[model samples]
Target chain A: MFWSVTQSLLGGLLTTFQIFLFTLLFALPLGLILAFGSMTRFKPLRCLVQVLVWIIRGTPLMLQLIIIFYGPGLWLGHNIWSGNEAGRITATVVAFSINYACYFSVIFRGGIEGVPAGQREAGQVLGMTKSQIFFKVTLLQMVKRVVPPMSNEIITLVKDTSLARIIAAYELTFAGYSFMKSNGLTWPLFYTGVFYLLFVGILTLLFNHIERRLDYFR
Target chain B: MAILEVNDISKNFGSTTVLHKVSFSLEEGSALAIIGSSGSGKTTLLRCLNFLERPDNGSIVVRGETLFDASMPFKEQEKGLRTKRLHFGMVFQSFNLFPQYTALENVTLAEGLLAKEREDYKQNKKTICEQIEKHGRELLDQMGLADRMTHYPHQLSGGQQQRVAIARALALKPDILCFDEPTSALDPELTGEVLKVIRGLAEQRTTMIIVTHEMAFARDVSDKLIFMDDGVIVEQGDPKQVIDHPREERTRQFLTRYAQG
Candidate 1:
């Protein structure tokens, strides 16, 4: 009985990990693009991106997941996502990526702007083109500045993955809760906390390693 | 021939004019020092020459080539602006080295990036990079930072950072190098080291335009000096002459204030 329960929770953990990985894969680059959009010199485009980011950030992630997963079926009279486990997971990932991307974009913008203006002026006087200056001078310094805040958001992302259970995506938390629903066993729910702890632990170690690598500068 | 010729460059922010019809010419292989009280537009003048700030009305002619003209269309003036900026190397009051890169990398980063534009960069990539590294090492050695080539900016002293900045500016072998109060940010002891580097460059006949408060150093190093007051040149001639005997009341008052301070 114990082995079977552990095996079941492991399957759920896999789904949780999948959601976490895919959200980052999509959101990291998306966040940088959004950051540039919000910072663009073109006023209209900047305003448009800022407004969109504001809306995404203002709403709750759980509400976004519900709307993305079920709203189309209710409002459009047709479900865009198929009635399957894969479809639910896909909807959950989409909502999570968009939500986290907005948060990350704000962090990225802060990091980029934190670099001293004199640094860019130095690049300009060195004969570097604007793009060259951004990539070589500004971008590297930005990465250093963003790491601490970025690590905070990423850890928060790990815990927020549990929100996917709201869409019936059988993630780790749901797997744990299912034991209480079926067998009237609550110990598995406690067991599921171990998986999240381990995941967050590994992430903490990885971020520490990255911070150490970047410590050569300042 | 004059290496740089500026005619009636003017700049205004909103309604207040920062510089009004500032004009000057720099001879080849000579150093010109600009000294003035704060807000006298000395830094702004240097910025206009390097294209960091646009002049509202004027022309900048370098090597007899018109680089900037107020009469030109905005788009036309912006065209080739980056390459034109290569004519003047700038060293800031703050030694604005890229903190992430090593001292040597800070010196070579620009040259390495510019090297990619060469048509032969692909076939000669290894050799070109080796040459760049060699030149970078030599420059660091010249800056007395041979052992600090691999040290990040945070690991170096202010004087060392400024020397690296000077080396970085010189890597492109600019026709004219501009220093905007290069030692203003350093302590008195550190100031001597940076000044020594500039003194060596001056002795080598490096054409330079310096904006500085080091009146004695300015007199010793610069061939010509300009005293600016209220966004205009108050008096300019030999550095020693301007320092010893000023013709304008504003220049004399400013010099006396600086002396007492």
Candidate 2:
């Protein structure tokens, strides 16, 4: 029975990992784009992006997931998403990416701004074009600055994937919870905690390695 | 012919005028030093020469070409600002080297980026890169940083960082190199090394414009000196004459205060 429970939870962990990976793949670049949008010199675009980020960050991720998964069918009077496991997973990933991208953008903006203005001026006087300065000088420094805060958000993201269970997505937590409903067993729920700890432990090691590599400078 | 000419440059930030019709000219292979109290606009003038700051009303001409003209729209002036900036290399007081890059990478980065634009870059990539690396190393060696090329900025002393910055600036072979109080951030002990490098550059007839408070070094190393007060050049001429015999009351007052301080 213990072995069976472990196997079932492993299946759900796969789904959990997919959500985590897909969210990052979409959110990382989106966060940088949003960061640029928030920092744009043009007042209108900056204001618009700031408002969008504010709205996304002000609300709860769980609420966002529910609304995105169900709102399209409710408001439009037709289900835009197909009623299948893939559809539910897609909605969850979309909600998670948008939610995390906003948080990541704030971190990115802080990192970018924290680099001294003199660095950019040095690039300018070296005859570098603006984009060249951004990529070569500003971006590399920003990666160093953003790493600690970004690691925090990424670890938080790992735990937050459990929120997908709310919309009946059969992720790790849901798999652990299902045994209690069917077999009247609660130990598997405790087992799920171990999986999360191991996942977070691996992430901690990876972040430590990255932070060490970046230590070559600061 | 003057290698650089600044004709009536003025800059205003909102209602406060920072530079008031400042004018000066720099001859090729001659070093000019600008000495002033803080807020006297000496740094702004150097920045204007490097196109780091746009003058509200004036023109900057280098090598008989008008690089910036206030009569042109700001958009038009910006169009070629990057290329125009190549005419002058700048070193900041903070030694603003990219911390992530080693001294050698910092020195070669700009040249390597510019080389990518050459039509023959694809066919001659290896040779071009090797040439850039060789030049970068030579400049670093000239700055007395021969053994420290692989060290990151944070690993170097303030004086060493400034030397790397000088080497980085020289990597581009700019017509005029500008320094904005390059030694101001260094310790008194460290200032000598940086000054020695600048003095060597002067001896080699590398054209330079320096904004500094090192009055004695300015007097010895510069061909011409300018004394600025309240956004204008109060006195300028032979460095020895300007430092030893001031022609303006403000210049005298500033010198006396500097001497006392």
Docking class of 2: high
For B23-43, candidate 1 gives per-residue lDDT tens digits of: 899999999999999999999
Error of 2 at A126 (Å): 0.7
TM-score of chain B of each: 0.99, 0.99
lDDT tens digits, residue span A111-177, model 1: 9899999999999988899899999999978998999999999999988988988889988999999
Best by DockQ: 2
C-alpha DockQ of every model: 0.86, 0.91
Candidate 1 residue pairs that clash: none
TM-score of each: 0.98, 0.99
Residue B88 deviation, candidate 2, in Å? Answer: 0.3
Q: Provide backbone clash counts, one per model.
A: 0, 0
The candidate that wins on TM-score is: 2
